[model samples]
Target: MAEEKLPTRAEDFAEWYNQLVVRADLADYAPVRGCMVVKPYGWALWENITSWLDGEFKKTGHVNAAFPTLIPMSFFEKEKEHVEGFAPELAVVTHGGGVELEEKLAVRPTSETIIGHMYSKWVKSWRDLPLLIVQWGSVLRWEMRTKLFLRTTEFYWHEGHTAHVSEEEAKEEMYRILDIYERFCFEEAAIPVLKGTKSETERFAGAQITTSIEAMMWDKRALQSGTSHYFGDNFAKAFEIQFLNKDNKLTFAQTTSWAISSRIIGAMIMVHGDDNGLVLPPRLAPIQAVVVPIFKNDAEKEKVMEVADRIFAELKTAGIRIKMDDRDNVSSGFKFNDWEMRGVPVRVEIGPKDVEKGSVALARRDKPGREGKTFVPQAGLDSAVSDLLADIQASLLKRATEYRDANIHNVEDFEELKQVVQDGWAFSYWCESRECETKVKEEAKATTRNIPFNQPDTEGTCVVCGKPSKRKAYFAKAY
Candidate 1:
């Protein structure tokens, strides 16, 4: 089963991703269109992602809670902009238990409206100033086009909603979450990202400010990995979430919402994966290392298995997520290919010869083929494996960062910007006007990804309209 070769990314990037998702046992298409069934392997990967994020949220004083899946349609009307933004995608429920319902319900496209309504009732005094809650679940959007993990009608994520007494506090919360998200991408996922604020036209509906972490994929297209939005008093005013201040005056609460969804898995695959298969970061991979015993006969099998089992136990004791692949039905080569496809960060192979030599063959996933293989003493092998995993993690981040920097070209004019965006990202001065933004989208098929916080001390003219501009923005075709 591992013998079949996938289409090379250079030949067909889209098909390569589509086939790899299923062949790698991550997910499969469901009977329902626009939905996917995440297999156990994929769920384990997601579990690792959520576990890290959940811990970080708790450390920041946020608590987890669940809301009803079905929210009354009327709740959406409370926030006009939000409803308009999501109106086309909402999956409305008009019948329940075989009876036609008078009032319709919208499958939770997002929990903002419902969460706002609940916050209105829960928050009444200055003491309840900051209510930070996160919900972990799936949302239905009725998407017309869907990819395995990137986009789907129903997808998994954790949405965080927080209410603060002041706009300053709410905006701080928004930026704080974006910082955490950027760290997650760098340290855990080994994907370098740019953190910045979204353009007005791209900001979340009803949000005063929207920020995101953008990452460049292998194809040089940008993917919005995570987003954090500051809603000011929009939601609070709409939902009547009023509280008495220190001066005893009533005021609407300032709110923020942020999320990092499963689409991040797609980002990882595109950033670190290769023609061979996935090259997962050690910190986030479900199986950090896999142990395979190589043998030709029963005698060899016994010797190899003894060493392999001991090494697996040692690695597991050292806090490594290890797997023992001692299947007799398949060839050792088959096991290697199988684990390679799964993107286990490290592979430990102990054959009879290695057992006799008191050594094991270590293969690094990030560096494929013989170049990545080495013979290391089995003594203190656990430390050796740990060090290798760390190196691989660092190496992935370095490689991806270099690639991203190399592909971003600064443009001095509209024609140059058009050419740059065809094969890479165009970093140029922008007027931050919808007219200029739309012109680029219409002509070059690129949109403003974000206005990066890191900008030149000196201002320049807009590339599109030649208007005075204060900041530079990334223009790219996005996922």
Candidate 2:
């Protein structure tokens, strides 16, 4: 049988992405507008991501909590900036029991306001300082445009809210989370990132600092994989979240919040997936390895099957996620294409030929080959997979690191900066002026993605106005 053909990315990246997402059967458009139905495969991938992230959070002393998805409009009105930033994207629920309610309740675009209301009632003393909590739940935003896993109306995410006694501690949480985020992406997802802080114009509303990890995709566009924000007593003041110290002084608590959502799935799709199909990092792949059997006659089949069974048992005992595909109806070629599309990180091929040779063919999804593929002797299968997985993980990170470098352009003039950012990101000396920011955005459909953290305080003129600039900032047209 002929293998199914996949859409070429060069033909149209947007269409190709859509085709790969739906064709791979990972997810589908939901009945309700702007929502997505994550299929078993897709949900399995998310589970893998969440399981890993949850452990990481626990290691950092962040406890998981639950929060409701609805928030009363009155709660939003308490924070001036939070209200303005999210009001436009809120979904209002005005009826209950088929009757109009007295007050409208906004479906959460975020939980800061609702969670803040609860904090006001719960916090009573300095001992409650550094209240660290995280929640994994669904959030709704009335998005104008929705992609499979990028900007859907409703998506699952882990949102963390922490309260501290001082602004410095609050800000410290932001950087700490940023570090975890960068390490997670590069180490687990195998996607390299540029870490930075958002400019005032682009910072989360009511946040004093917004730190982010930005990754470049195949389309030359940047995807914000994660963010950490410092509110610094802003929400505390708005919600009257105060505690009394031993000095007998009542002080509003400082707060910080951060999140990484299903959007990281989209980033992984764009970063590692190619024209053929999905190319997942081994650590993130739901099915780490699949075993496909090949046979000819009854004698050959029995011999291959016996070896396959033994090999599968050994791999499982070694703590590997292994699947045995013995469907006799379909040819092995079809299985190869399907599994490749779904991004099974490794494949073990056992056939009559391999049984006689006392070895099996090993194929890696991320690193495709055109010539005679490699194999590992039966005794070496376990060790070979361990080495291959580590190599693929590092390979993906190196590839993305190169893409990030290639897309980032440092322009000295406004006109060049505008041209450069159209395709991807541009870094240039910025004066940190909102008016200057507005001028740049007006001329180019780009915003400051971030003021890079710990960048050299280079002495250079602003790309737009020729005035002295203190720091360099990354500008990009984002997803």
Candidate 3:
């Protein structure tokens, strides 16, 4: 069969993304428009994500639960602003069992509405101050623009909702979830992110504060990896989620919720993938390392298999996700292309020449710029491959950090801010006026994405209106 070729990233970024997702055998468009069918490889990657994220949620004292997919329209109206913001995107069901229903139920655009209704009932006393619940499931939104995992009609995500006694505690909880999300994406996924709070106009519906961890894609567009909301009694008041305090006073409790979805899968593809295909981090890669046993003929096949099986067994015992390529129909060159396309962090090739020479060839998928890969001696192949995986993980993070640093810049004026925002993040002094925020967005096509946590008051005029500055806002054109 002929090799299927696709558009190069330089040819067109959008085309490159679409080609990579399908060509890598990750996902396919389902019969439903704007929705995708995650193939085995893509689902396996998501399984890896949920496994790690669920463990983190458990470590943070959150319990997992399932919620019904369809929610009553009345439940959505409980939160006033929430309903208005989400009403347009909702997919509602008006009939059940071929009969018209009295009240229409909407497929959850987000679980906040349904979950808020449950939260009201789940709490009644001071003892229920902190009701932490998490759910992992698929959600539907009538999306107009869909790009595989980037933006889909139906996508899987793990959302966490926590209720608390006061706004102070809720803020802390919001930041805590942000920390967990940052750790998961940056540390495990090897994607660098910028931590900041979104501007009022960009904040989540009904949230007092919205904090996000934003990562820039290879296309220079920002991908919102995860978001945490500090809802200060807004949902509680709407849904009547009140509890008796220690002094027997009825108070509307505070709530916070956060989520990281399969969107990270899209971010991962854009950040690390190349013309070849997806380059997943070793820690998150479905197959960390693939052993491609090179054999010249039948004389060497049995011996190579013995060595390959031994290496695979050792890695498996070490709790590594490993694969061994033992097919006889394909040549070593074809196997190399296949594994590289899948972006296995490490590939070990052992053949008759290496078996006789007591050395094996090792290849790092990332270091292609090094001309060619170096060999791993038989006595040291196992240890060397382990070290290579670690190096690849660290190298990817370092590369992305440099990209982030290069893209993020401080702008002194409107023109400077406009140019900076086109490429990446621009931290500029803002007058803290809603009008100026709107102006920046209107003229530059960039919004006030966030007010960074670490930024202190500075002596500078507003980048847009040249008024007294309130905060240094990070502006960017987002996904």
Candidate 4:
């Protein structure tokens, strides 16, 4: 059978996303409603993401621990805002062990409530206040509409919860995590993002401040790549998580929690994928390089396979994740397309002639132009491939950064804001009022992506209400 071509992204982006996600072997619909079965390839990508971030978390003084998946109803009720925010989406467990229970249990949508409860018990004095714990697990949120990784009811993520003696310390921890997330997205995923504080209406439930890293997709819609929340003793006071200060007085500890989820995989697909398929950043690709040996006959096969094996071994020894394809049943054309769809960062083609010439043809997945491929001699081939992978990674980030910046528009009035936001990000001064924010979303289907951290704090008139504003807000149609 001929290989099937995915729907063109320009014609239908949503359909293209769905087809590419499945065709590329990333994930699929689960048997259960509103869930997905993350296949091995998809899980491997997530694993790489987690492992990289995990090191960063540790460097910042976080240690991993697991919390129970189920939370008691009383825990949710402890924080009024949190309960109100998640109540409609809670999945209740009325009967455990096949019998009725007196109090209902809720599966975790996020782990703040439970982790806060634990910290309340584990902390006693100022010495124990800076408790940093990380959990890698799955969370379930009942969703009416579900997309694979973007809005799934059940998904995997790493959530870090910490308590500090002072509000200043807690705020610093929150910002520190946000910085780490920004580095991960830029360096590892090759996805450029806007870092800023979320508007009050969009901030996390029960948080005094919420910051995020938002990345724009190919369709110009924003994807919230990661978030850091500063609770400022909101949950700590609610849960009565009191700790003795150095002055010998009891006070509630400040709290913070941050997370990045499987949804990042979706963001990567949208940001880097092309009509051909997913174009993975070299750093995150499971198989960084795939060696496909081409031979027409037994004699040619023997010689080509010998050279391919040697090259693969050299790359492997040099700490590159690679695979050699020497299947006789399938044509080379099939192998090429298959690997391309899988988004292998680099492909090394070794034919009889190339083997005889002690060289291999290298093709990069990120570049669709003629310059993507080149012939490199086998001597120091491993170093050549490494340099090529680094170039591909950097080029992907440069292209994405350029696109994101170009789509951002500076508009002075609501009318101009609405016009530019139809297909890109609009930079305008917002009054920071719920009424004005809601009006913009209701009329233009755009919300405040963030109040960027580094933008100048100049006085300007609000885009919608014409009121005095403190800073420019990033507005966009988001996922």
Best by lDDT: 1
With candidate 3 superimposed using the best TM-score fit, by how many Å does residue 156's alpha carbon deviate from the native?
0.9
By summed lDDT, which 10 consecutive residues of candidate 2 come out lowest? 367-376
Better of 1 and 3 by TM-score: 1
TM-score of each: 0.99, 0.97, 0.97, 0.98
lDDT of 2: 0.87
Total backbone collisions for each predicted model: 0, 0, 0, 0
Please report how far candidate 3 places residue 398 from its true position, in Å.
0.4
Models sorted by lDDT, best on top: 1, 4, 2, 3
lDDT of each: 0.94, 0.87, 0.85, 0.92
- Model 3: how far is 27 from its true place, Å? 1.0
Better of 2 and 4 by TM-score: 4
Cα misplacement distance, residue 469 of candidate 2 (Å)? 0.5
Clash pairs, model 2 backbone: none
Error of 1 at 424 (Å): 0.9
Off by over 4 Å in 1: none
Evaluate residue 305 in candidate 1 and report its C-alpha lDDT on the 0 to 100 scale: 87
Q: In model 3, which regions exceed 4 Å deviation? A: 1-3, 369-372
